[model samples]
Target chain A: MSMGSEKKAKRVRIAPFITILFFLIMGIVGIMTGEVRRVLEQAVQVCLSCIGIG
Target chain B: MEIVRKWIQTIMALLVNGSWSFPFTRTIYQGPLKVVCSPGLNCYSCPASTTYCPIGSLQQLMAGIRIAIENGQNFFGLYVVGTMGVLGGVFGRLICGWACPFGLIQELLHKIPSRKFSIPQKLNYIKYGFLLFFVFLLPLTVVDKFGYGELWFCKYVCPAGTLEAGLPMLMLQPALGQTIGLVFFNKLAILVGFILWSILASRPFCRTTCPLGAFYALFKKLKLVKLRHIEENCTRCEACHSVCPMGVKFNESPENAECISCLKCMDKACKFDAITLEIAGLPMGSRAGARIHRPKQGEVSM
Candidate 1:
């Protein structure tokens, strides 16, 4: 591969780290804002729609 | 490697749906683990499930976003989005190939001795529509008198929900049969259709319908772990195409959005070192180094 292509490949490889870091920050904010608890409340109940009963 | 992948998939399916007590109790698991989201498309309503389905949880959040905003509650669903994002970034559609219970079921169903068919490539784009409409747009836009939206995907489309939760729940508690209506029958029809299609085609739902798989496909080009196609080493032999469950032609586009990273191309089909498993652009191992012995013809490599 050419040097330019190699550089592009490096950038592509780095993209996942950046994406993961951004989402991880958002996840921490969600947890701090009590999103986990909300999700838990929703999940604990048998979702009627999920069981095709709604 | 195929055997190893199958074992991992089976173990993952069992581990996520680990509430074995459901058979005797006839009730869904409400353990603390339900708070965690499984990476695959297993249903939270499944009696034996220990974790939530991200797509279902996402729909729940989307459907209630209006009410949440009016009530001054957080409605971003950042945690679920982040969870999905992190998993997708790390593995991409490898979860579909190796972890998803529904994907495993489809693969096993396809294994039943029968004539197989290929899905139209254009249909692959339909999943993005399902992700946009059923998972997000419909739920967020359409609301009831109370300003609460419905779980559109789970209620109308998800065969996983029907197979894992609906059928079992109805069988376990026959009293719930009174509640069955057109919607239940509709979902059952979709489930039956997909089951039959799975036998006829490989992973038809994952290829054409799954919103979660669509979400993961967004990260295919940038996922940390990926199959790197070595163009110079390739001989234009279309062996990889024949073995791909997701129908990815690796040489033409190494980063095809449809690829599930199942490693069938790398581990089973490639005679040349055209494909290599990579982590962050670094080649972890070659295909030859990974396989001890190759399966013979008609031996069920998948």
Candidate 2:
């Protein structure tokens, strides 16, 4: 593959990088602001009820 | 007969409970005498399960509202998935092959009578996308009214969760049934879909849905535990391909991250033992080292 093609592949892989960055930010905000943590808790409870599995 | 022995052992371990159950059964079996039992996905959350499952634990942690406390310390119970991943990067998804309850479930599902099928090749990569979006990103980003993260796949798509925890919980604690809603039906649909797909294929969960498998796949090439192919001896006969349930082209890379390290092709085929587990440190290639193992006479693949 040409250098340009290789660069394109690397660029495509950028999605993963963005994804990882997003999660890291969320995790930090969750741990620091506690807002994210609270959201996570409510989500889990809602899911439990939704699935009807307790 | 060997399969029967494995079944007996698994049942006994489950009934006995305690540490004798599950994965410990796996560890003991791997102690020297290898004994594999149970051919389906059976996470520790299953009423039948005796050991704690990492996937189930991860889901529970993500979904858990209240964590129990013991001995003056708060314990998230089974929130060991993150630890598993940290350590997995060390030995990797060997757990998928040996210890994972769900992986076992999929294997057993292959035994059901049906016309096996493999999804379109290019479409298979959709799993990595699932891993990223459903397993990781969504869970991390999508919060609830309260603030804790959501285990997106477990809450939304995991059949293992539905079967292992949902069905059994509802059956054992029928009161739980009254709470059922549209989400219940949605998960039920997903559970049924995967079960139907498994009957037609081998491990639909492992191939396209398992986040744990996805995590391990990332470390597959780097981990010393790998399927090695002595390429110099390879004849390119593609014997391993026919035997592989995951539909991986083994010879393309001896150790592809997609592999569960089930060793089915190597044990049954590979007349020359050309494809074998090599402990020596070898960097993973872009893909994997393709291995073509010839199955022995009278050996039937799932």
Candidate 3:
């Protein structure tokens, strides 16, 4: 097998597992800490016009 | 499809920031929808911006977490980080191709008649530095006496902030011009420099300095949506590599972070249909058929 194909197969095998693991950890932490509410509050308010538009 | 995606993304950007009647509105959109993160790097400070820029929100969360830690309060920026990870995991840099207004702007600038140039592959890592220092580190560590961390990336580097918010804000309210100091001009200069660079090299900023792009790029390997290469069918023709605007050698690394999933190197460039789009490993777009033409014996496929 060529180098590209070999690498592609290896990555495909590992990637999905890593992605799922990351999301699982993050979800647990966010729920436990109430960080979701904090993020929502920050998202709602526009800050001082630093970039000039808002 | 890329063009259609671009138009849809541009309209989404405009519509999301659709509070035009309040052009001089200093207050941000404080609606229920604001809790959702925008996929693109649209500036939250823009008068019309209803949802928050993920990068900005990430920085805010980082800074806040740092301050909370200092104050001995329990705080962690899990939500912003989690949302970003989910988006990045699902789409990778496809967001750059289909959603970002700034990415659209860079592409439009690149389309102007000019001599095109390519950046060194090594330079791609600079965006990570911006994410680490400007967006996260500096904002968390570099606090004033009042214990307030400045939004370094938004203030100093993000051209999207300047174009979407700063310039328009200045134009709308001339009285605020006096407050425009070294920081504003410095950002404006960076924005102008990026504009020139984009005209010369497609997505110069996206490739070299966009922290948001860097953040999403980390998930390129695990992304649900991806570009796939079928080794059996490839003629080793470099058409895909040659046509790639980001200069990714996709034949070798179909899921490289630098690939924005523009699909230019797929059906258009590959006559043999060697390359394809894939969602969760399911094949998409046109399928591979017979080789366009057999290569003569001993001719190099690479």
Best by TM-score: 1
Report how far off residue B98 is in candidate 3 (Å): 0.7
lDDT, candidate 3, at B54: 78
Quote each prediction's TM-score.
Answer: 0.93, 0.65, 0.87
**Predicted complex 2: CAPRI docking category:** incorrect
lDDT of 2 at B95: 54
iRMSD for every model:
2.0, 12.2, 3.6
Which portions of model 1 show Cα errors greater than 4 Å?
A1-12, B289-302
Q: lDDT tens digits, residues B59-84, model 1?
A: 99999988888888986789999899
Task: Assess each prediction's global lDDT (C-alpha) against the native.
Answer: 0.88, 0.54, 0.77
Query: Model 2 chain B — which ten-residue stretch has the worst lDDT?
Result: B28-37
| lDDT at residue B101 of model 3 (Cα atoms) | 83
Tens-digit per-residue lDDT, A1-54, candidate 1: 578756644554688899889888888888888889889898878877656795
Extract clashing residue pairs from model 3: A51-B166, A52-B165, A52-B166, A53-B165, A53-B166, B17-B48
- DockQ winner: 1
Better of 2 and 3 by TM-score: 3
Candidate numbers, best lDDT first, in rank order? 1, 3, 2
